[model samples]
Target: MEVDVKLFGDLREGRFEQEKTQLEENSRVIDVIKKCNLPLEHVAVCFVNNCQAEFGQVLEDGDRIAFSPPVGGM
Candidate 1:
């Protein structure tokens, strides 16, 4: 079981390289975040398969997970 993870915005930039990760199924969003060594404070938005999902949501195989920071411009 594997899931596709897509990082966006500052999150992607912070990770240096590699925008995607294949994680085991039944893993929660938080698990991936931890595996990536990403700080919780840097996360502002998260989606699963186009729907807003919580960090605790258990990921399923083939799920598309997108992560991004809060973006604002003036």
Candidate 2:
């Protein structure tokens, strides 16, 4: 199975801003995060195919996944 992944903010450091990745059947959103070596605590939002999704959300082949890291500004 393959999915499109988008990383936002600091999450893109040393990683592709957007890319496709292969995964096993029944992979969840968290799996993708781990595969990207992103800290779970830093992830503030997740979207699948432009819809809000939870970490436990099951991923499907060709699904579009976007991740946003926590943001802060003064």
Candidate 3:
């Protein structure tokens, strides 16, 4: 299956802003993070097709996955 991935904050520092990636059927949110070479600890949140998602959330073809890294601000 193919999915769209979006990286935010530090997550995008050395990665593309967005990408179209391929994964096996039933791939999960954490699988995408691993494929992107991002540390699991760096992700603060994840959204699938605009809805908040958990690491184990199974991904579907054409699903849009967005990841946000930990942010610090006043």
Candidate 4:
């Protein structure tokens, strides 16, 4: 399946800001994270198709996923 992905904050520093990646069938959010080599600890939230998602959330073809690193300070 092909999933559209985007990264926010420092998560995209050494990686792509947005991309369309191929993943195995039934791949979950965490799978994509691993495929991108993102630091699991830094992933603060996930959005699938613009809605909040959990790591175990299943992904589908053409789904849009955004991964954001934790934001701090006030």
Candidate 5:
């Protein structure tokens, strides 16, 4: 499966702000985070298809996810 990922704040450092990423079947939101090598502690807000989502939320193919940090931090 594949999903679109958008990273905000320092989460983009050493990474990309947006990209289409490949994933295994039944992957959750947190799986995408780990695949991006992101720091979970830095994620202040997360949305899936524009709705607030949790780390354990299951992702569907072609889902769009945006992750943001707290204002100035990541």
Candidate 6:
């Protein structure tokens, strides 16, 4: 299975690639993040195919995942 992925914030900067990536079948959202070495603690939000998702969410083929890092400031 192939999944479309989008990384935001520091993760993208670290990987230097914002393009979609293909992953194996039954891959979880956290799996992709791990591939980029991103810490879930730093993520503010995550979406799968436009719906809010969690680390345990399983990704399907053609699924689109997006990540946004947490921002802190007053």
- Best candidate, TM-score: 4
**Per-candidate alpha-carbon RMSD to the true structure:** 2.5, 1.8, 1.6, 1.4, 1.9, 2.1
- The global C-alpha lDDT for each of the candidates, from Candidate 1 onward, is 0.79, 0.95, 0.94, 0.96, 0.92, 0.80
Question: On residues 10-61, what C-alpha lDDT tens digit does candidate 6 reach at each position?
Answer: 7577565455677878889989888767786877788999999999998888
TM-score of 6: 0.80
Judged by lDDT relative to the true structure, which candidate is superior, 3 or 4? 4
* Steric clash pairs (candidate 4): none
Error in Å for residue 35 of model 3: 0.3
What candidate 5 gets wrong by more than 4 Å, as runs, is: 72-74
Tens-digit lDDT track of model 1 for 1-74? 66677777777664643345677757899998898877888888888899999999998877887778778841
Candidate 5 per-residue lDDT over residues 1-74, each given as its tens digit: 99999998788999998999999999999999899888888888999999999999999999999999889542
For 1-74, candidate 4 gives per-residue lDDT tens digits of 99999999999998999999999999999999999999999899999999999999999999999999889841
TM-score per prediction, in order, is 0.81, 0.94, 0.94, 0.95, 0.92, 0.80
TM-score (C-alpha, index-matched) for candidate 1: 0.81
Error of 1 at 68 (Å): 0.7
lDDT-better candidate, 4 vs 6: 4
Candidate 2 per-residue lDDT over residues 1-74, each given as its tens digit: 99999999999989889999999999999999999999999899999999999999999999999999888751
Give me the overall lDDT of model 5: 0.92
Q: Model 3: which residue pairs collide?
A: none
Model 2, position 35: C-alpha lDDT score: 98
TM-score (C-alpha, index-matched) for candidate 4: 0.95
**Which of the predicted structures, 1 or 2, would earn the higher TM-score when compared with the native?**
2
Task: Kindly report which residue stretches of model 3 are placed more than 4 angstroms away from their true locations once superposed.
Answer: none
Error of 4 at 44 (Å): 0.2
Which pairs of residues collide in model 5?
none
